[model samples]
Target: MKFRKATKKDVQAIVEMIADDALGKTRENFQTPLPKAYYNAFENINNDNNQELIIVENENAEIIGTLQLSFIQYLTYKGGIRAQIEAVRIKRDKRGTGLGTKMFEWAIKRAKERSAHVLQLTTDKKRPEAIVFYEKLGFVASHEGMKMHFS
Candidate 1:
């Protein structure tokens, strides 16, 4: 598989991969379909060197997976840097074929290139398989992730 930064032309494919999980349900709990605003954000991110969004394509050049890496610089840790992975998804038929691992490895390299001190992400507790997959990738549950929903 080959990986490259996502272009505007890849938005529809990204939406499809994200909205159609292997479990047959869209990962977001909201009833409404994915919004255009969400995708527009990618436009700004794609232009920023600090934010990277990548897509994985097979030998035939068909997009099969996507992931985003956001770099954060902090002063509290004396100028520490971190990369957070988000929206990692593989097309339903592409799971367990090592594509996910390849995407992650690419993200890791991007993080290192950006001089990030750590890489992190959060997965829903309901997705036990995802938690195990993160663990297998050498991630540890170091903190209790929290969220405050407005709606």
Candidate 2:
């Protein structure tokens, strides 16, 4: 598998994988010629050095997974950098192929390469299997996460 930063052309494949999940289907409007907002957001991320919208491709160069990794700098931990992973999704037919694990390994190495002090992520509680998968990656539930949606 090849891991690389996503180009504008990869947006549709990335969005498709995201919307394949139950929760994502509700919030993501994935369709033919996807909403312009998705491309706009991708543009913003592409311009930011600290943000990476990643894509994983197979031997045929077909997109098989996607994720967004953000490097956040803050005052806490003495000006530490934190790597946050979000919006992870593997193509429906590509799961269980070790692609997911390989992606994280890449992300972890990337965080270290960037000198990030910690790597973090937040997964919806409704996805129990996801929680377990994350645990297997050595992440601990050390803090309670809270969120408020305007909608």
Candidate 3:
């Protein structure tokens, strides 16, 4: 598998992978004539130096996994920077093949290279398996996370 920063052209494939899962099928709108919001968001992420949308592809050049990393410089923790991992998704067919582990490993490496003091991510509580996977990767449930959606 190969990993690279995502381009605008990769947005569709990434969205499709995201929508393939049960939860995503309920939330993502991957219908005929894709939504402009996806492209708009992609452009926004691509323009931000602190944010990265990554794509992982197989030898066949098919995009099979994706994730986003955002580096935030904050005043807390002795003015340390934190790397936030988000939108981690892998194609359903590719889930059990060690690709997810590799992806997290890569993210951790990148975060350390960026001099981030911490790497963190929030997974939906509904995905118990994902929580276990993250714990295996050395993440802890240290704090409660709450969000209020406005849409």
List the candidates' TM-scores in order: 0.88, 0.98, 0.97
True-structure lDDT of candidate 2: 0.94
Give RMSD to native, each candidate.
2.8, 0.7, 0.9
Relative to the true structure, how large is the alpha-carbon lDDT of every model? 0.84, 0.94, 0.94
True-vs-predicted CA distance for residue 40, candidate 1, Å: 1.8
Off by over 4 Å in 3: none
Per-residue alpha-carbon lDDT of model 1 for 62-93, expressed as tens digits? 99999989999998567989999998999889
RMSD from true fold, candidate 3: 0.9
Candidate order by lDDT, highest to lowest?
2, 3, 1
lDDT of 2 by residue, 10-74 (tens): 99998999999999999999999899999999999999999999999889998999999999999
Model 1 ranges off by over 4 Å:
22-35
In model 1, the worst 10-residue window by lDDT is: 23-32
Pairs in clash, predicted candidate 2: none
Worst 10 residues of 3 by lDDT: 25-34
At residue 80, candidate 2 shows an lDDT of: 96
